[model samples]
Target: MNLVLWIFTGLLATALLVSTVKAFLPREKIAATGPAAEWILDFSPGALRTIAGLEFLAAIGLILPAALDIAPILVPITATCVALLFVGATTVRLRRGERKTAVGDLVYLAIAIFIAIGRFGPWAFTS
Candidate 1:
């Protein structure tokens, strides 16, 4: 369970880091957009910025809430939310016939779901 948590933490942290970096990058026009880019661009830059902020916050929530044992519910909530986002992302990619992107989202979704279940279920950490 600890191993699972660590893996999930690493994955979420990596995602948060990458997305935050991307949010600061120059925005390009949505030309020749792929499935993932198209889906992300459906939301305006402001909305995407908000979502990226939330993702970064959620990444902190996954670790901090549990570690501090304050507002512990946040851990599972973050995991669940990220998992759901990945699910939607995977669905969009699949619908767009983007197998590689769908697979990547599936991997993320699986890790997030595992973290959600582990944190909220029997393996819950208590500090």
Candidate 2:
């Protein structure tokens, strides 16, 4: 179960890191990438960067403390924050009528929630 949670955490962190790349790009460049990126057009570059910064932090938070055994408890806390982030993402997509994107956001949310639950429950690191 711990291994499973680690795998999930690694994958989520990778996804967040990938997304962060686009966040550093110009908003126009991101929006021009494809239909999937069109949502960036609705946000200012600063807002997008802020979201990306959170994602970067979440990615690090999901792995570092736990991996280092310094404060594994932070893993679940970060996962919870990541879940909330996706909840907001889903809400925004739904409000914009981007049903397709909203579905993707919900999937990420579920994954984040799963990580949070697992880390906070049976798979949690002790002391």
Model 2 Cα lDDT, one tens digit per residue, 83-111: 99999998888888889878888888988
Clashes of 1: 0
| lDDT (Cα, tens digit) per residue for candidate 1, span 68-93 | 78988787788999988888778778
Best-matching candidate per lDDT: 2
Per-prediction tally of clashes: 0, 0
Best by TM-score: 2
lDDT of 1 at 15: 84
Q: Candidate 1's C-alpha lDDT?
A: 0.75
The segments of candidate 2 whose C-alpha lies over 4 angstroms from its true place after superposition are none
- Screening candidate 1 with a backbone cut-off below 3 angstroms (N, C-alpha, C), the clashing residue pairs are none
Flag clash pairs in model 2: none
